[model samples]
Target: MNQHIQPPTSTASSRIYDILRKDLVGGRFAAGEKLAINALKEQYQVGLSPLREALNKLAAYGLLIQENQRGFRVPRLSRAELDDIAQMRLALEGMAFEQAIVHGDAAWEAELLAAEHRLKCADMTLDKDDEWERLHTQFHRTLVAPCGSVWLLRFIEQLHDQFDRYRRLGPKMPVIRQELDQQHHELVELAMQRDAQAARTLLDDHIRKSYDVALQCFLEHSG
Candidate 1:
């Protein structure tokens, strides 16, 4: 019989934290799944302390719930809560897009163009590389990076993360990709022309459309 040896690596707490975060955001953990600390410690080859720390971090991010004597589990999404999140995203992202149009300079325009080019080269297929998803996110972030409001960006990022799991689940929808690309093109074009009103309208519509699709998918799947 041959014995297997594992490689030594980074701090258990950080490693556990990163892995859990990725899995939570990717929907691999699934919503409302119980997170048993002992099982996690065994799976990650870590101790209870590191597993607890990782769970605490996830709870802080609203991705997990730490109940009294019940341990941790994935957070549940209610329809009302989802609607609130969507509305907030629309308001914040719409404002950011408008401000970017007003405040963005030539350098911002250049960056936006470069980002768009990178996004265009991204593989949008269902089996696309994870790197493409990362770049796609960066390109969208770059579009509104000139907004100059830290709180606004923070809120938008939170909404983006919450929405991303559903987005990934429905990537194979043709209408999703077609509408997304069309909206991105229009947004970039309007921003380049510094048309604040048109850009904001497009941005609002783009965000709302995705929210609607995600909500529909979420409901269907949950049912």
Candidate 2:
């Protein structure tokens, strides 16, 4: 009699992938830290197959780096990588926002305002409140949802995940965060008014502010 072989289940793999991705984005693992397979199995209480599947998916998403001989490790932080992600976001999201403003209807405006409201009600602290993190992601996605470009949305999401890891793991500065909500309010007002150029400029400056904070944190920590 031949032995029976069971293939990896998609449900298990997908569940583990979501869980692991959340952990990675939440900065559960330190940069350049080696991920030991057996230890992870014990920690996540998952079988090997699903864990490996999740890890490979994460690596493909640029959250992890797969070594040639060794296994996977979190990507190391650098100024170059950080700046690249920031610049890409500014260009891509700026385009998306401008198009969204041009194409957005009353429904789009309603949803964007609602998302802003929800996000403002949350803690709004990077890495401090999980609810805030989720709402913030939703709010930004709503801003560009009317852009009507699948590729643009997809790329923006990937870049967001990459940049958010740095935001969550880096040092926090409360003093610099005071103006964020005001910026958000102004952005919503501009979008509602259909001022594409002004909105784009504001959005550009908004992203740069976060980039500056992330850069400062990176420098201080890496110094």
Give the top-scoring candidate (lDDT). Answer: 2
Prediction 2 global C-alpha lDDT: 0.86
Question: How far is 160's C-alpha from truth in model 1 (Å)?
Answer: 1.1
What TM-score does candidate 1 get on C-alpha atoms?
A: 0.84
Q: Tell me which residue pairs clash in candidate 2.
A: none
Best by TM-score: 2
True-vs-predicted CA distance for residue 86, candidate 1, Å: 1.0
Q: 156-203 in candidate 1: lDDT tens per residue? A: 887887777665554456676678767777789999988999888888
- Which regions of candidate 2 fall more than 4 Å away from where they truly are? 1-8, 124-127
TM agreement with the true structure for every prediction = 0.84, 0.91
